[model samples]
Target: GDARGAGRPTGERSGRPTGDARGAGRPGEARRDSGYRGTGNPAADRYAAKKSGAGKPRQKPSGPRAFGGERFGKDLGPVRRPKAARTSRPADELDMHNPDGVRLQKVMASAGVASRRVCEEMILDGRVEVDGTIVRELGVRVVPSEVSIHVDGMRLQLNEDLKYYVFNKPRGVISTMEDPEGRPSIGNFLKNKNKNERLFHVGRLDAETEGLLLLTNDGELTNRLTHPSYEVPKTYYVQVRGPMGPGIGAQMKEGIELEDGISKVDSFKLIDSTPGHILVEVVLHSGKNRVVRRLFDAVGHPVERLVRTQIGPIRLNDQRQGSIRVLGRQEVGHLLASVGL
Candidate 1:
């Protein structure tokens, strides 16, 4: 954006800007009411202004600067921008009213949707929805926490009470917030963390196991994710002794009997292998404690190292171990929708 301005001849930096000629070193600078402009050079600017009849009276434009602060061809009169394609509808048709409630634009802006004015345009353009219904009205009022808002069909989470985070749980660290045995726990990473109100780990990862562990204060989401009924997927990276036999993945997908129950992997992939050790990926929805280790043990491979790389829609990705990262709006939205929250 600055490249064009940097190379501009009439910029504030191109020689002295203060002179008898108004806006010296500024090229094509003209009043909205007047088309006559300055062309940088003092003598040339005076001549051009005189030639264009700079002093002639002009009609003031009555509306927005949609003309891009300069004139375009007269044919494209007042066309704003290319909004996303959606069925055109009258905003006033939907009469969602709560006089005491906050404005829709305010809620959207607070949720990081966009600036207040841009949000208004989005509402007017029919890009925002509330409670499964498209709402184009700018004055629509509803409680941010109560309504399910979506922008362009992506869910927007607006509950300020809820917080979401992803932590890379390194090996040797206990999963609990506070360890009674005085071992390194999740609390260590949160020492300087200011937002500790009701912050809870979503699920458990054994002290020896490591990788992505979702942390959140949203109780309902936590319960739903860990609950067996929802069957939220969790993926793990397992390191085990190599020269492993084939079809272990098939055997897993088929069924593997355990003391508690007959559990099976949703998916399995051989990530890497060598004679000494091998890395494999295991996906399952079971929340059983130490399930990954037991799965490998049942297959006669025995897990040497284990890492929970992903939990449902959230992935560890490139985050460094022992670090905590806040889940963004999109991530939180998908997470909430995963279990129908």
Candidate 2:
């Protein structure tokens, strides 16, 4: 029924069949061909396309695209940009976050040569130089890398001093190099000074109070001991104007109120007492100004004489008055332990 065996000129049959003539007998079929047909019948072309593998399996879109309907043109939504590359920076650039750099005056003050202001004077006087060059500026940055800092041509090792001495500070001796009013200072009592390294006092002993005081050139240690959070304990021997009755102990233990607020005594003991005066030992952990004098004055008594016997775990020991002794390594360790350093 294909008409191929009749050899009716395979040209017409093999090329394209005349679908219009074939559909003439079928009126409804000719209407279907007229919708999309060109010069040749679209139904014959569609049949040929199906036979030649045009109707092969088609892949379904997946994920977000599976739900998206057909669209025209290329997708032009945002495209991610690559991250920029990082470059190295120089060491001189300040972090601005860290504040560990020591100030110029403080470095000089800690070196034991002078106060911060005095060090500036010395620097301006052409006495301070760094790495063989005279530097007269205040707050000149100096790293602890042996940058070769010197005062008046004498090479100064800012941290090499390691001096730690306890002075049985005598009354009338101000705890400084030279008093502004020309009064004799603690430096007057010190003999055989080392010119290479400087020395400075840790804390002050008033001009009229005789007690134990430590001196050092270590700035870091000085900062730590003086830091309020440390709460370093100080023991004082007080000579008051009246006999310390049992009520005195209770009042001291309860904390006495001063003008500033309550002044606390960690512990107190009545060492010896007379009807006219009492010798009491008080232990406290405050760095408030003139605390012992104020506490006694609060309790209807006055301190006739006060002497500091201990700082933290360091005691004056048998070191006599007017004598200076360096704190031993073990003693320094005990001091660190007292403040939980």
Candidate 3:
């Protein structure tokens, strides 16, 4: 009785267990309490047990210490193998609106069917049909497995063989396709040419001037070659109505001051001379509008006829004023070598 507490009253519940039948003294059994007599509720006994055991210390389960020790396991069991890459996530996909995706016009152009812009116009005109259905939208995308595209009712195929050529264009042809004013264009020379590859001029050539021009379907190469900062050399043969004096060549080489600014020729030389006419060669790296004509005019020798004779290592080579020949691989290589390509 004295072990219960000092000077405790008789039969008082001391919030602890005495050696009674309810106090089973087992590992998981609850301790007995005189205050809980006749309660017949196991919930209150379980709650009391949980509250008492929570005050006791606890031990962490087996694993490396989350914050302190270096007990990381040595089990090398292939690490649950990262959940086998899901096929639900696609490897690659084509987006119709993306510029680099499989675009309708570019697909037609690659098929040797027509120029991209022309194909676009054809789609708008309902001339281009895919798998027997007309596709008039601009950004319609198609994959190789999903498309059987046709232009003008004929199946199309992509041409892989790239062709590059240089043309020493003559005057009287506009650079564009079907000019609004209905003037003749250099494209006439390319029309119905029995060539498999469709040709496109890299840069513009004005109606009244002539010079070396590059033509190819290789857009990347065209972009690189025609960029103005490349400053590729272009040589011209100009005939003036009057003899250009000796010092005139020097002054032109030194850059002729025009109404706009100092217009310059890279080099110049008098080739042939007559009392009323002078034939001279002028070299320039500029593609400015009528630059050679403007320079000659600035120097008091308005050009009577202007013909571009050479561009880089390419020459006109006796080809008629309105003819074109495909450039050989070696020639293309030489051009690629130029401009530090």
Candidate order, lDDT descending: 1, 2, 3
lDDT values, one for every candidate: 0.81, 0.68, 0.66
Query: Which is superior by TM-score, 1 or 2?
Result: 1
Write down the TM-score for model 2.
0.51
Worst 10 residues of 3 by lDDT: 82-91
User: lDDT by residue for model 2 over 275-335, one digit each (tens)?
Assistant: 7988888898888888888888888788788888999878987788777887765465456
Model 1 stretches with alpha carbons more than 4 Å out = 1-95, 115-127
lDDT of 3 by residue, 179-218 (tens): 6777876556665653445667876767788766777887
Candidate 1 vs candidate 3, lDDT winner: 1
Candidate 2 vs 3: which has more lDDT: 2
**Candidate 2 or 3, higher TM-score?**
2
What are the TM-scores, per candidate, against the unseen true structure? 0.70, 0.51, 0.50
Q: Please estimate how well model 1 matches the true structure, expressed as its whole-model Cα lDDT.
A: 0.81
Give lDDT tens digits, candidate 1, residues 1-341. 56745754563554444344464355765433255445557788667876766644666674444433434448755546455565644444555556777999998888887899999988887798888887867768887767888887778888877788899999999988888999999888884653456688988988899999888888888899989999999999899998888899999999889998988899999999877999999899998878878878999999899998998889999999999988998898888888886
Q: Candidate 2's error at 232, in angstroms?
A: 0.4
Candidate achieving the largest lDDT: 1
Q: Backbone clash tally for model 2?
A: 0
